[model samples]
Target: MKKLLIIGTMPIILDMNADSSSDSEEEEIGETEETTQKPITCLISHDECYVAPQLLNELYVEIFARVPCSEYWKLQFLNKRFSQLLKSSEIFRMRQKLGLVKPYLFLLSSGANRWTMFDKDFESFLKLPKLSSNICFFNGDKEVTSVGTQLIVIGKEVEGITVWRFELEMQKWVKGPAMITPRVMFGSASHGTNAFFAGGVKIDKNSYEVVSIAEKYNAETKTWTAIHAMHKRRKLCSGFFLRGKFYVLGGQNENDEYLTCAESYNEVTDSWELIPNMLKDMPVLFSQAPPRIAVVNDNLYLLETSLNELHVYDVNANAWKKLGVVPVGAHFTRGWGVAFKSVGDELLVIGASSARPQSQSMTVYKCRPDVEEIVWEECKRCCRGVRLNHFILNCCVMLA
Candidate 1:
């Protein structure tokens, strides 16, 4: 087959099946600097990428790693070298080592055709490529989490349940190497390159079963490894990493009983330590959303859905202290539509703006919860052109 590489209005056709081998890739790049390999300010011609050694593989990886991830799609059509480098995801690994991996926000709104992606500043936005799935996937409840540069979305379609991954460098969606076990309403959290999922409802033909199973996914291998299960079988719980431990909190047990206890997994021992009554003091409302939680500056904060209040978790005391009222209408949908996450050193909350028309715009706020007094400063200039539905269906942050 042939290939057509198009960038903007210009169209360039080339052989897609070309092997395009190079000697520069074989050179050792990780061990030391390539002192003998010379650097060129620019590519002299498109053909030189494969036919000659102009840029060292280390230089290419370092240059691309520093470039904003938003511009990765454009690099795809540059040449065969750029395409292969990105497709291999070597740049992503370098980004981690260089401490250049930055977070990006992805929001799936109610009735939206595509997921909207925003930079950390929230000044600009773009729509991600639509998922290639049946209507069952879009309409059904979805669980989303980000591992490294990939966005993993889990939901049911016509073919039972499936996992779809959105690769950052490729700028497209691909059917996943499915999870170790397919489940719904699972608690998930990402630590560096690995994603943790645990305690969910595993659905089958006739009935659904609540499970205590847990699994960890390695993004580099695109593989899931089964981990030790939680002490209690729960669904609708939430998961987050705090103080180097994976914590699962607040969900319904196998017998449909509301659980206040929490569990933490220790990788050193591969066992779960159950903490009873971790959320006992908080009032449990009917059909409440799974604890809207975020950890900022090593401090865990929970968005109380019933009263739009914020509370900080005292890890030592195992208690929650109310901070103050939030500006959004979190209780409108019982906390389902709001997005709570930690972006860098601050707590970010996005939801229906209580003061204005929620259908036309979302309220964005961020605060450093570690301070003596909490102050949520709203981002008044977020994506003015595209009025987003405040009722966010799901949200995830990708560090790429």
Candidate 2:
């Protein structure tokens, strides 16, 4: 076998001949010794990438595979082959590791309340039909809970417990366990492998009274136990885990004065503390306002219902500033349905519940980093008619 190595436009040919007989042999010998050479032209924008053709493919897979996307895309324009590989499955695998695929959103439902769950780009919502009862969402991770495939509804008696579970592969809902507490207007938050339920009226109608009891349920152990009591009773209050603390905010007291107080439960010490009244310095824009909060980065954002104002509290600075207001006519329209969910780098402001005599609809707006002119748009197309209150984002199964 003969080998020829070509670099640039320069081509080298190998020739061999053996001297033999007469004039005819001399002609054959001259033809065999004749060699052709051509100069090869090549262009390169970057000097580092130059390589021989045989090793080019291997070089690319090794180089761009590890290069940051900003640098990899620049290489993509070099040739059609590189561009195709950039859009190929291998590159998407790189993106998956980078957390770039459509992120996770889990929709959770209870008999009376609904919430959306997500982290990164994924989002999901729980579906609720009209006039249904007996519902709860469960998960083991308190930091990022899942709307368990399980569903529970309480009938007229404590024994009347109905359970349902959704199988993703089969795409159907099957039966599960019965809830220990048959009540509505309760708040549920998960920590570790257990979910805690607190503060809901049993809704006995004529016997209607707010319930102050707290209970914790283990999804793994499948058991329930009553926990420490809350300092002040709260119903329809927002529940969230922030900075290793459980924050319960803005629920009605026995008199239902639209309490503007906030309380925190520490998991480390198993204690509850009343946070100082901070929003009072700001005017009471709406006496009926339901305050909501969202944590972006490490900062806490308080969405005051009264003024449609966005007050941000910096965790590092321990300071508060009113950045901007939600669009007009945003709140109280969907009563208990309003919530904030994080989508990528921004917060998704979802409007739910009916504050007025209006149809049940949901709107989601993107809260921008810019203090002025934050974007608020209707997220109905994405959320459907499902409403979310205290929507929390979590990272679970990544669905591309």
Candidate 3:
């Protein structure tokens, strides 16, 4: 009878089928089978396959670190090992160490409770989780900001000021501490570990009133502390952090007049200093709508959504200079829905294209600032056949 055996440090025996025969005949058959079949050994115990798990893990980390952030979600489903490695911070650390981090554009569209992130490396929009239905009941009027990889959304709900934070690492949204005051059309920005909110419209006696209150939320403590108010009441304004100070720019006052004055707040001194108005040297033809601003290489840029134009502020000169119109094909929804974020030397703008309503496309433009001119280049175009009635509510640039 022919027999088989598995050989290793721990051996296993297997019996083979055989007919009745003499002991000598059975031995002969067993010998024949042994001569024809090699001894089975553990493949993992073989010299060539004897790789350490740590070494294999290191190899996995190195290989996966180069993978584009856009494909991470799909790759996580490959296997348990792959999912574990992808979720490990070690892989992201390796990516950062190897300088593989790239900029990604994240968009929050009004009426769409989910976020759409555009991966420039792959020129694709990644699938994101849907926001909680409870969170979706609120209106789209909100202030968006980012600190590190977290995107903060602040909006006034029926209860009070609701704050939600999206963690890019875990790919989920969590409720943040509620604001002390319920306000809308607020000027907000993220600075270091805290998010600052400035003047905004508050409801008083069923009427809207612009207030001059200022506060900052400490993310670590999950608390909001009142800070010195801005020098002027600002509503429908925008705020940005630069040079260790928070700057509020271009908003309407209680008089419902567009503000030309700008101010910077010093956290250390608890004071505000008036800065040169963005409209100081601009032509009267510029729209009164507050322009979207972004900071690139410590320089400030303003995007006039109506004209699809760009302007740069000279800190030393205290003047704003027009950098001409953005790329010709760029489109905005109702002279709004445009967002600007600085990634390295490029300013990334995201908005809808001028296609028909039923076939509107979401487009991203990369603006390269030069000494003579600002060159706009198309980065990615998606949602080709999908109609997007909702405006681009908020957008921020993230690195991964």
Candidate 4:
């Protein structure tokens, strides 16, 4: 049974609508109205299985948690008992207890209303349910982050700003449970089942104010808790989690000036420690996306937008060491369109083929920057097929 869980990636279509009859809140597999579109898949292998009626349910839950959540639908074939467990959140809860998770990359491209979800290896993809809000939510700028099984998308609607969430378990877009103070251009990051949002602009009437407020969302409770605000008011910043701490890095301030400083939030102390001039030497354009930064194994790595080069942060010296250019381009757009994030231990970057040239097809590459040697390995499988919009409006990595 354990062997069935560790098999290599075998792509299979996931009909998210497979079991809509279940009344479980955590297992909303699929609710798609587009019958013409393709389905999703899971990392799987074909094998025989038999359920022992005498086996403890706890043991089964432990075993099933090892399987990818994308493959949960297939588990119904095991037996009636297994089917019941799949509909419930018991196995998912066990997964969290065991700290077992896989990252799924969600991307929203330019000029496109629908978002796409790709498996870790980019073996197969799934289109998220369309947003149920007004046109403003689609055309305006969007900030996205995922907490646990939910993918939260924030943007404006017709009359005012709104928040839309893509619930992975329910397999649909749900409106509301909005932010305590609705915002845009915020810095957001996720750790485990919780997501953190901080430092953005709040628009009311004709005026918009850059804000320093911070909030945390608990996926289980479906609620938000306000936290200690950062010492600085900045928008267009980036948020990352490292060493049990949340860090907010480089962004533009309320005065329309670029800020080189950063802030680190200590959950234990319940306070934010201002890290002044943390990015004083960082390279960026006059106006662009937040610093292209991602953390792996407690070390922070940054992409120099002007050079398309990779640099590692020195925690002791508070400096950066250049690691050479990434396989993808970034200089042309000044780092606006690139999707930079840490996928497990490797640094995953998706962008154009060159620093200056443009292409309809984006390149996908990953590298282990923590080791002695840094080599960008291109996911050739991901580059093929229908190409993505070269300019990524937003990208998020959700651990399920």
For every candidate in turn, the CA RMSD to the true structure comes to 6.1, 16.5, 11.9, 8.9
lDDT ranking from best candidate downward: 1, 4, 3, 2
lDDT of 1 at 95: 92
lDDT of 3 at 381: 46
Give the best candidate by lDDT. Answer: 1
Clashing pairs for model 4 are 14-40, 16-30, 28-169, 28-170
Count backbone clashes in candidate 2: 25
Candidate 1 TM-score, true structure as reference: 0.87
lDDT of 3 by residue, 1-400 (tens): 3333322232222223311222321211112333333222222333222334455456457656776665565555444555665545666677878998777777776556577776654246765687663543355466777654567777755555677877665577788666777677878777645778899988645777799899888654567899998888988888887878899987888887778888888989988888756555543332344457888778898876656678888888788778887642233343456667787787876665433334445566676785665667765444443334335777777666
Query: If scored against the real structure, what TM-score would every candidate get?
Result: 0.87, 0.52, 0.69, 0.81
Query: Model 4 over residues 207-260: C-alpha lDDT tens digits?
Result: 899999999888777788999999999999999997898999989999989999
Ranking by TM-score: 1, 4, 3, 2
Residue 241, candidate 1: alpha-carbon lDDT: 94
lDDT of each: 0.82, 0.46, 0.65, 0.77
* Higher-ranked by lDDT: 1 or 3: 1
lDDT value, residue 221 of candidate 2: 49
RMSD of 1: 6.1
Q: Give the TM-score of candidate 4.
A: 0.81
